[model samples]
Target: MVYIAAVVAVVITALVVGDDTRGAAGDPFGADQAIRYIVFLTVGYMLARGLAKAGSWARRDDHG
Candidate 1:
């Protein structure tokens, strides 16, 4: 879980910081980009958590 979150964070950070697809227009950490990063991070976290929970449930069902 921690590993998944870490990877997501790193990937998002790289995209936002790099800003290759979307030009920075001067500020590296532009407010719009910051918002995008935040939104993406939140969604990634939620998905990771849901996946972890589902995996645990499946494992329990398999054993029992």
Candidate 2:
């Protein structure tokens, strides 16, 4: 959720600011770059979460 929100904010700012020229801070990314970054973040987060949950287990005992 945080990643999605951040990317959205960045893309919105870039579009609204309307400046892609290289400045002291370097060139700002466009919408396409933002989309790619979000995709990478999503994939990396999924992999990390999957690894973290791989050892967890839960059960409901009916014999209790």
Best by lDDT: 2
User: Candidate 1 residues 1-64, lDDT tens each?
Assistant: 6756765665577556755656547646556765676677679888988998877745535765
- The most accurate candidate by TM-score is 2
What lDDT does each candidate get? 0.67, 0.71
lDDT score of residue 5 within candidate 1: 70
* Residue-by-residue lDDT tens digits, candidate 2, 1-64: 8867876786786676537465667545667776787788789888988988886564456453
Give the TM-score (vs. native) of candidate 1. Answer: 0.47
Residue-level lDDT for 46 in candidate 1: 89
Q: Which segments of candidate 1 are over 4 A away from where they belong?
A: 1-25, 58-64
Q: Write down the lDDT that model 1 would get.
A: 0.67
Please give the lDDT score at residue 60 for candidate 1.
Answer: 39
Candidate 2: residue 48 Cα off by (Å): 1.9
